[model samples]
Target: MAASRRLTQFALVMTVAAALAAAGCASGLGGGTYQRTEARRTMTVQFGTVESVRPVLLEGTKTPVGAGAGAAVGGLAGSTIGHGRGAAAGAILGAVAGGLAGAAIEEGVTRRQGVEITVRLEGGSYLAVVQEDEGEQFRPGERVRLLRDGGTTRVTR
Candidate 1:
């Protein structure tokens, strides 16, 4: 039972890691790149304050190992309470109950929450970025400038 629980935990961690890797790959492909220009330029930038922060809940799927481990542990515990056929039957019933409880607990704990930030670009483009850090804050109508290879992307208030 202990071995099964350990394996289940490892599998869950691996699955989550894979999903995070995939998401990172996807994001790396999406951000646009700025080319360096020969000319020098200055620009004014505008910023927007975060009106609201929303947590995005990612749905998680179930793993059979979690249930199996739960059942095994439950059965073992249940078997200790009775004798003969009663003990055997109790173990089976306990295993089923434990499996369900384990599954529910795993599901609840593995859920991930992401923060979405809405920013207004200077050129009137609205950009939303999902970030793991929720403590970062940007004020609305703030002026900011980015110096890139001579060309500047400015956000003006």
Candidate 2:
């Protein structure tokens, strides 16, 4: 009986964690039109020569998904462990631990490495653009297009 209860709780916790992760993935996408904070304008295209290419790791930002999931799971598991006062204490500890673990997991999942391409424009000026390395590698001295749209910019072949 006790073993079955423990198994059920464990499964519930796992389900909650999976749901939280899926939620994160779903909310990550933004609708197109334009963001209120983003600059509104047409893309300004310019030709440039790649001056350098360097690899870089982009840090991930934390969200409540992990902590929230962790807390719910921890609280549930903790509730099963003790009597009234002890149960409360266990829940608190579990929540803190779960939150920390969730945050770490989120960071790990979202973190990515990319490349910074430094391009020297026709007038001898330099600009660097960092983007996801989608296998479209850029080499020094290679010709490319720099597209600037409002406050955002991108480099392409």
Candidate 3:
């Protein structure tokens, strides 16, 4: 009877973990992508030539979702480990471990390969922009346009 109960709890925990993993996968950070709020907003256009392009990594979004999901799953799984006080201790430890693991997993899953583009504007000032790689390669001396919307900017052909 106890074994059967433990098995069921383990399965439930696994199901939750799978769902959380799927939820962590988000949209791209490419140059072409924009947030919903950015639509229809006017952007300042600046012409420039690419001075250099370097590879980079864009970090993932840090939210409470991952940690919360992990904690719930871990607590449930750990509660099955022992009875009474032992189970309580296990649950606490498991939640801590799960929260850290979930955060790391979320970050690794959302991490993207990006590029740092150095551009020399027509006004003679130099600027560097980093954006997720969207198969649009920028080479040194290539002409491009910089679109600035407040604090945000994007480079395009």
TM-score of model 1 relative to the true fold? 0.45
Would you list the C-alpha lDDT of every candidate in the order shown? Answer: 0.52, 0.74, 0.83
User: Mind giving the per-residue lDDT tens digits that candidate 3 earns over 7-123?
Assistant: 857776775667466655577777899988889999999999999999998998667767766777777677778899999998898888878777676677678899999999999
- The TM-score ranking, best first, is 3, 2, 1
Each candidate's number of clashing pairs is 12, 0, 0
The Cα error of candidate 1 at residue 100, in Å, is: 1.2
Scored by lDDT, the top model is 3
The better-scoring model by lDDT among 1 and 2 is 2
| Residues 60-138 of candidate 1: C-alpha lDDT, one tens digit per residue | 4466655665676667666655689998998889888978976665555545455554665556676665544333343
Identify the candidate with maximal TM-score: 3
Lowest lDDT block of 10, candidate 1: 26-35
Off by over 4 Å in 2: 1-20, 23-41
Residue range 17-51, candidate 2, lDDT tens digits: 68456545622211122345555556788899999
**Candidates 2 and 3, the one with greater TM-score:** 3
lDDT score, candidate 3, position 152:
90
Candidate 3 segments whose C-alpha is farther than 4 A from its true place: 2-25
Q: Could you give the candidate ranking by lDDT, starting with the highest? A: 3, 2, 1
